[model samples]
Target: MRNPEKKTEIRIVLTSDGSSSVFNPEFNQHYHSVFGALQESQRIFLELGLYAAFERFEQINVFEMGFGTGLNALLTLLEAEKNQRTVTYTAVETHPLSMEQARELNFDTLLNCHYLKPLHEAPWNRPVSITPVFDLVKYEGRLQDFQTTNRYNLVYFDAFAPEAQPELWTQEIFEQLAAMMQQGGLLTTYCSKSSVKWNLRAAGFLVEKHRGPAHKRDVLRAIRL
Candidate 1:
């Protein structure tokens, strides 16, 4: 597994919507869109991915490609609590933030939600229940090396931009992910690149281009076939 601490430096940066995101110096990437981190995550991952999945399944198994800053997981946990929906969320990340780094983010302050600390502090490689309806399991390692027997109903493909991490956006990776999803399962990502769309198609997903949040023009949502 890649040691992000040795090769990368992270800094907190404010987005347009008053949320903070991590900026990775090695990849020249921010964890979320610069236009608005909260907005982007809410619209794409939560609204388009999780909520949509909940409409089709009573119990949801969500797999996240990147768990940077824990914004997406925290938001999902809040949503699950509000609706009393059962959610089993599993996320894989090569570089998890230190407790101090997680505390520096302003998501809890901005969202007025107090679960960020618990979400970040949850133990790795084990299931932990932050709330009655929400369970989380975080894996600290590379996506390519991660293994899971759980078939996910929803996926938040929140990796860095393709320009930064081309390997993660390829057909092989999508094929591997496709094998782990159930039929009609949903996968959403912030990127709308043609290569990404094509790769998803090649991996046996029915792809659609959706209106993105904030400054992004388009995002991709795919269903497993």
Candidate 2:
């Protein structure tokens, strides 16, 4: 289920304790909050999927499903910096976070153990180039409405769980995403549900399960064959 209350600023939903249910706390902050979900997303999607994919792709393009709060984008910047890789980050966010709140999240701490006060302070929707390391460009839209003109090296399919957002897991969306991937491009998601796996295959991917991050058992890693 979706979050009951929408947070206009940070674009976060309050998650229930150990449940996927997102709700706004009476005091604010979603059920899962910022630090917990974003950190886990980085460890699983970027550290494992995006980073690994970049090793083989010289000019990497990343399409993220949810730009919720720009956490994944921030992590991608740091990862690109450390790996010294060229990345063009294209992210979709129907709900973009506010600059003031994003600044409050202190993303600078995530930048190479050093304080990148500039990145932390960069306003949302502003594409910033950290150079051969990172070039972030954001498109503000719903994931379902995205249409790509170029093939991407990797797709961080980091949307909400299929149970939560079934529309995102449909074969139609997968087919569109498949059209945007170069041969051998990979789509990584934190979900390993059987239906999700089947849908991806229906869209023409070679889907397989992989080790997930903390608290999760398995994740799906799909490659264009």
Candidate 3:
């Protein structure tokens, strides 16, 4: 369980791309990069994570870690519409944002999207259709406790930096996730630290480096083969 005292002090921060993210003093980290939230999501997750897999498969199943602010989910939902593909998105978060906090985010107005509100309002632990093309199931629990019978085609590993939450970036965690994926499944993250790449390789993934978005130099795209 997340510390209640720590949850009381989240601050909203505006990124360079005119998108809003939260800064958590407990973790001493911002939910998205300070440079640009939307750009980071699009560059790392949408373009690299989802679209990269779309080139090979029509419909995709995505599993996301740390679904903060629902930005990546919203972006993936938009991509599903653009490609006319079906997307089943499942996200797991230990400490989810409150209704008040989620409503305060400006993503709806920024992206001209009305579904952002409903996405946050959707019930946890049940599959809800944000649109006909996108289906979302959010788990209000930690990833370690999550058990699934379904294997994913892609993974958006959007946790905080490895320095902040080292447990989530370990070889055991990667192996666990890799076990739940189909062959050739892709896992993309904003982290490209050498230790992270080493651990991904130790867990049976072929890691590739890619040019990152602004302020970040590189990101990782690992394949479970």
Among the numbered candidates, top lDDT falls to: 1
lDDT at 35 for candidate 2?
35
Off by over 4 Å in 3: 1-8
Using all chains and alpha carbons, the TM-scores for the candidates as numbered come to 0.96, 0.78, 0.95
Candidate 3, 1-225: lDDT as tens digits: 444343546888899999999998888999999899999999999888898889967779999998889999998888798878999999998778877788888888999878788888888888999899999999888888899999998999998888889999999999999999989999999999999999999999999999999989999999997
Compared with the true structure, all predictions reach lDDT values of 0.91, 0.67, 0.90
**Residue ranges of candidate 2 with Cα displaced over 4 Å:** 1-35, 110-128
Q: Which clashing pairs does model 1 show?
A: none
**Quick one: ranking by lDDT, best first?**
1, 3, 2
CA lDDT for candidate 2: 0.67
Off by over 4 Å in 1: 1-8
Error of 2 at 188 (Å): 0.7
CA lDDT for candidate 1: 0.91
| Model 1 residue 102 distance off true place after TM-score fit, in angstroms | 0.4
TM-score of 1: 0.96
Pick by TM-score: 1 or 2, better one: 1
Per-residue lDDT tens digits for candidate 1, residues 127-157, read 9999999999999888999887889989999
